[model samples]
Target: MSNQHQLRASVLASYGATALEIEELLAYNQNIFDRSFSTLPTKFPLPPEPHVAAWEEYATLAQEIGVFQALSSKLVQLQFPILEGISQTQVYRFATRKGVSADDMVEATGLILQQPEQLQLILHQSFVGVIPVLLASNREDFVSLVQALTMRNEPKPVPDSMGAYMVTGFNNWDRVRQYRQQWSAKNFGNCSESSWLEEFGRLILQKHLYQDRLIILSDGFYSNVSASDIGLSEVEWRRISLTIRLEHECTHYFTQRLFGSMRNNLLDELIADYRGIVAAIGHYRADWFLRFLGLESFPDYREGGRLQNYRGQPPLSENAFKILQALVKSAAENLERFDAQYGQELRTLNSQPIMLIALTYLTLEELACSEAHSYIQKILDQLRTSLKEAEEHLKSKP
Candidate 1:
């Protein structure tokens, strides 16, 4: 075997791939023959105009909702879905008669951990730009709220493993109402909702509502792994897990706002998890990441491991699936090594933005290859130079 072949064989062996499986992977040969990595951009792209506008609008809404204030006095309440045979009004009255405050009602309905006042609207500063974040402390509440908001108040089943949800181009009904009134006056010289106006509103106005983007985050253990699993106390683990979740979702927000594409894919997950891990603990742990993806035992993937979530659109064949697992394992190990060597230098320069920008240039296949280190190092060097020059330019300004 050639040196490249020998290295490939070695990786497959380490992951406990059977000889037959190795041969099948070699035959598939997608990763083996094609090793193209994109050239890194000199600077990160600016956030798109629409994204910037959306952030501003969300900030205004947050202020209007008193998101920054303490939770004691706010009486914000969401119209939670009514249970079977019970009117929503009755539910509210029952809770009120029982002396349940609005906050307690929300909590008792499993829509949030505490009062609705505790729901914070954070304008998180990210490399792309400031993105709005709706931070929820409870996992159950996070799932339900996301379903309600994104699914038109429908009671959809949300997966327990999902800790964060991104809301993009979400219609603000308040804005929709204002737009409808204006449109009605312009078209018919009246603001009343006639039958024709209602039909038009249903078909057309709904599509044109002022759209916004935000992330709904849950403060759950990263990948639902408890503190005991990672050898940490409950409090410390919860804190770190929240940081990881926030950073992970922010990474997605970064890509969505800048690259204009976000998908349910392993490569995206890998990149997000890398940023999340580094942000939380200042280093990458391949084992922890693998565990998060249900690859801790390699050949035997855990039943509910996150890896099952991104099996591709049409899904991969069994042979292809095995090969994918091997690739992911190799890629993760390479990333961990890269972080260990360059993490301190990157952190010293506060280079997360540039780092994330550089990472977008490579693929999982390229990262899994034997030359992965060289490929990443080349991009990092270019990004570092750009970052330094930008800093120098800023310093010269004042």
Candidate 2:
């Protein structure tokens, strides 16, 4: 067999399955897919709407047949490659307010049980977005998007979480070692160098063992930090930022704990990214409003303005990096000028200096999606014209 096939067989071995078994699973999946797409449903039920026939049929097949199970199993296995690439010394950490231990699995499971509805909703969203790809007549583009979305940096903590995980690890070696030891003790074989979910799973196990409510305090980028309180059972999943976390701390935290059960990494990251963008924008705008009212200080301009305005919250560096990469220098320069023009207000509002820049770049990406070159050129012209107007506005300033 080729090396590639050997590798696949090796990975499958962990599940106590032979190569033939894996192939059988693959064949089964293909058959299901063939059947599923053979008769495409006319309608799909979106959220808040009653489940339509199409929705029920798809959902039933996905959940009941071994499709979801097989996909989920493979996703977990594929996570090894992705997680292995990340530095373990860089992610996850135990929360300060409440530390966890191996004995806490029972309690942690209860918290998850109590919030089963939320978890289900997360699954539904993932299914909605990904099923189209699985069901698509021409699925190459959809598959590519799914891959991109899966790899996107959608989680990570608020600034404080980062400080606790990464920065603190650098400063507090003893505690860090203890934390890692505790993680290992709790997770054992499941913990990995780059698996944030595994570390997160360990935390959950520890939290439950200790019967602590604060175990799930850190909020991922995808989570809803505000409406999180609406649940009566009193479950707290706090938002933690990546900046302050140690290299591997958060990765380990997320991998074993939360990631293990999640079948769709692509949708998971998209939901998180969407939520992160909304929160960052909201926070940026709020800071702007606050500055207009002379109520707050400006955000830090050099360090992405996160420190200056948001204080404890920062955009995921990965997303920031992508935004920076997508922009042309001229477009980026114009955004800098725009931010500076409203410096006092922008600073007051806690806006990241990069946000406006990122948004403009995103607009450029949206423009690029068109197959018509003329359409793209027109969009570029409009952007240039808008920038020129902004420049004129700036020039007229005293």
- The best candidate by lDDT is 1
lDDT (Cα, tens digit) per residue for candidate 1, span 1-398: 46556666666665566787666555433231121223223344344434445445555656676553322222122444423322345545554322234454543353333446556778777666567787877565676567656654445666666788888876443444445566777778554547545645474544434566778888788787879978999999999988888889888887776566667777788889999998899999999899888888988898777888887656666866877788988899998998899888777424776676667766665678778899888887876776677667767996
In terms of TM-score, the best-performing candidate is 1
TM-score against truth, every candidate: 0.69, 0.20
lDDT at residue 50 of model 1 (Cα atoms): 44
Q: Global lDDT for candidate 2? A: 0.28
Q: Summarize candidate 2's per-residue lDDT along 174-221 as a digit string, tens digits.
A: 233345767778878866876645564564444323221000111232
**Lowest-sum lDDT 10-residue window in model 2:** 161-170
Q: Model 1, which residues run further than 4 Å from truth?
A: 1-117, 176-209, 348-350, 384-398
lDDT of each: 0.67, 0.28
How big is the positional error of residue 18 in model 2, measured in Å on the Cα after superposition? Answer: 67
- What shift in Å separates residue 364 of candidate 2 from its native position after superposition? 13
